[model samples]
Target chain A: MIGRLNHVAIAVLDMEEALKVYRDTLGGIVSDKVAQPDHGVSTVFVELPNTKIELLEPLGENSPINKFLERNTQGGIHHICYEVDDIIAARDQLVANGARILGDGEPKIGAHGKPVLFLHPKDFLGTLTELEQA
Target chain B: MIGRLNHVAIAVLDMEEALKVYRDTLGGIVSDKVAQPDHGVSTVFVELPNTKIELLEPLGENSPINKFLERNTQGGIHHICYEVDDIIAARDQLVANGARILGDGEPKIGAHGKPVLFLHPKDFLGTLTELEQA
Candidate 1:
């Protein structure tokens, strides 16, 4: 079951500009951009009191977010992550409920080094959802 | 300055379907649907430990989310609300930094009955942002 709202990931064309809005303009405590080549994105964390806003920029040519950026040129909210206690049990429950799991239907070590899986957007009201093990 | 991430609003075309995904599939604590006719939307809150997810459905003829639902079809992330200690000060800071405030540039009572202002998506990398007084 979903426990906490982990983070909201926003795919941006320009990380610097995104930082300006979330960090400079909004006065959030932002982390330095960190490249996650494995995940094919560069990430910047805007730390809020209760949660985090992750600003993502495509890292390479085949980055997953490149397609999202194509449709949303200026960038957009890519996905919302929820923390789950037991990911396997959660996935099974979701599968039983007719919700599709994305990729190979296996949990991958996510950016935060936690097991995570992506759920099909169509099953989630067009919102791309990520479930991370708490 | 942005303090907490108050909530993330997801606009959905079908409230029942959205509830099935959030409550039944994902096992989140969902609140009963409450129609905010003044705001032209019906809202359901998925209470998470850290924050909340607000599921919105068009309530009236001229619902604000109607256009968004038209474009997305299946619904999508509408906006993210961040809490601030002083909304006026936050507005001035954002305005000074060249962020455009939506509407008449004055804070209005949000769905939560707190002063809130929406920022232009163009100025926010396509992510509609709302700032509410904490």
Candidate 2:
């Protein structure tokens, strides 16, 4: 069952500049930062009163974030994360219902060290759906 | 500074079937419902442990939700909302920075009885942004 929202993920071209906007402009405080070499990106988060906002920048050319930034994506909203008690169960249900899982076989550790998985945008229409076990 | 996220809005075709997915299938509890004649949407909400998920179905053909559904859009993610203390200031800042507001002059009372406004997806690439005052 989904519990709550974990965080909203936003892709950015320049992590530093985005940080300034989230921090200085928006008056949000940086809560955490991590570099996931395997995921090929570095991420930073700002804690809000109720939830968190995550900013991601791809590290290299082959990284997904890099390609997303290369396309000159504009800044706005991104993926909406649903907090779930059992990510594996939710993933299974989604798969059983014909949804595509972004992770290989199981839920992977996400930016905030939560078990997270993405549903293929094609299966979810144009929206990117994320299931997070918190 | 903004507060916690109030809700995430999903544009769906059938409010009843969507409610089934969110309630019976997802094991969620419907927390609220509202019909906004001005917005031309009848919304139902399922409250999670952490945040609320809203389903929006347009009331008629002229409603934006109707046109969105008529496109046979797939089921997926939608807008990410930020909770703010001052909707007017946030809306003004967003407008000053070249963002377009869906609300004409002021934030309108949304389905949940909160003041809300939307930013055009074209202004923010393909992503829709919402500002909610709680």
Candidate 3:
């Protein structure tokens, strides 16, 4: 079951401009941009009192967010992540409920070094969802 | 300054289908649908430990999300709301920092009964942002 609302990832064309809005303009506690080449994105965390907003930038030529950026030229909200207690059990339950999981239905070590699985957007009301083990 | 992430609003075409994904599939604590005709949408809250996800369904022909749903077809993330201590001060600061406020540049009573203002998506890295009075 989903426990906490993890982070909302926004794919941006420019990380510096995104930082200006979230960090300087909104006055949020923002983390420095960290490149996750393995994940194919550069990430910046805007920490709030209750949750964090993740600003993601395409890293390389085949970056995962490149397609998203192409579709949404101005950038956009990419996915919402929810924390689950037991990822395997959660995946099983979701599968049993006719939910589609992305990437062979296997949990991968996510950016935070936690087991994470992505759910199909069509199955989730067109919202790309990521379930991270809490 | 932003205090907390008030909620992330997802606009869905079908409330029933959206409920099936968030309530049954994800096992989130879902609230009963509350129709806010005044706001032109029906809302359902998926309460997480730290924050909430608001599912919004169009209520009337002139619903604000109607255009968004038309473009997205299925559904999508509508906006992200952040709580602020003083909305006027926040708006003034944001305006001074070259952020454009939507509509008449005045705070309107949001669905949560708090004074809220929407920022131009173009000015916020394409993310529709709402600032609510905390």
Candidate 4:
């Protein structure tokens, strides 16, 4: 089951501009940008008290975030991540309950350096949901 | 700034079906359904360790959820709520920083019976951002 709201990922056309909004405008402490090549994103974390906001800019044209930006034009909320105590147990439980795990049905190292898997947006209403190992 | 993530709101066509996904499928503990007439939506809260998931179904045709569900068809993430120490201060700061607040630029009594205000999606990279008084 889900433990806590890990972070909400936002796709942005420009990371520097988005950084200005969260850091300069909203006064959120921003983390140093990190390239997540496997995930095809360059990410920066906006630290909040209880959770973090992940700013994602596409690493390449083939990146999933690029596709999202293509549709939204202005970029948008990409996904919401929830932390789970056990990634494998949660995966099996969700799969047993008819929830589909995305990709190869295996966990991948995510932006937080934790095992993460994505659930289909269709199954979770319209929002793409991600589960991360706590 | 933000205190914590209050909840992530998902707009669904049918509350029961959405409930099944979060409650039965994902093994989340859900709250009883409540009709928020003023907000023009019916909501149910799925409690997690650190935050809550708010499931919203349009109460009427004019409801905002109705519009989102119409576009997404299968429903999706509507908005995310972040708790603020002072809603008024947060609003003022955001506005001064060129972020446009939706509605009347005033706070409304939200589902949690706290003052809440929404920021335009355009300014926040297409994510409808909600700020609630913590």
Tell me, by lDDT, which candidate is best.
Answer: 1
How many times do residue backbones clash in model 2? 2
Can you write out model 3's per-residue Cα lDDT over B16-113, one digit (the tens) per residue?
98888888878889999999998999999999999989999999889999999989998989999999999999999999988899999999998889
DockQ of predicted candidate 4: 0.78
lDDT of every model, 2 decimals:
0.94, 0.71, 0.92, 0.88
B96, model 2: CA deviation in Å? 6.4
Quality of candidate 4's docking, in CAPRI categories?
Answer: medium
Docking class of 3: high
Q: After superposition, how far is residue B6 of candidate 1 from its true place, in Å?
A: 0.2
Interface RMSD of 2: 3.7
Better of 1 and 2 by TM-score: 1
Candidates 2 and 3: which is better by TM-score? 3
Which should have the higher DockQ, number 3 or number 4?
Answer: 3
DockQ of 3: 0.88
Candidate 3 lDDT score at position B21: 83
Quote model 2's TM-score: 0.80
Q: How far off is residue B32 in model 1, in Å?
A: 1.6
lDDT per residue as tens, model 2, A15-85? 77776566754567885568888778788887877787778777766777655555546643457677887
The fraction of reference interface contacts (C-alpha pairs within 8 A across chains A and B) present in each candidate is 0.91, 0.56, 0.90, 0.80
| Residue B23 accuracy (lDDT) in model 3 | 86
Off by over 4 Å in 2: A66-72, A93-99, A121-126, B31-33, B66-72, B89-102, B119-127
Worst 10 residues of 3 chain A by lDDT: A17-26
**DockQ of all candidate complexes:** 0.90, 0.44, 0.88, 0.78
Error of 1 at B34 (Å): 1.0
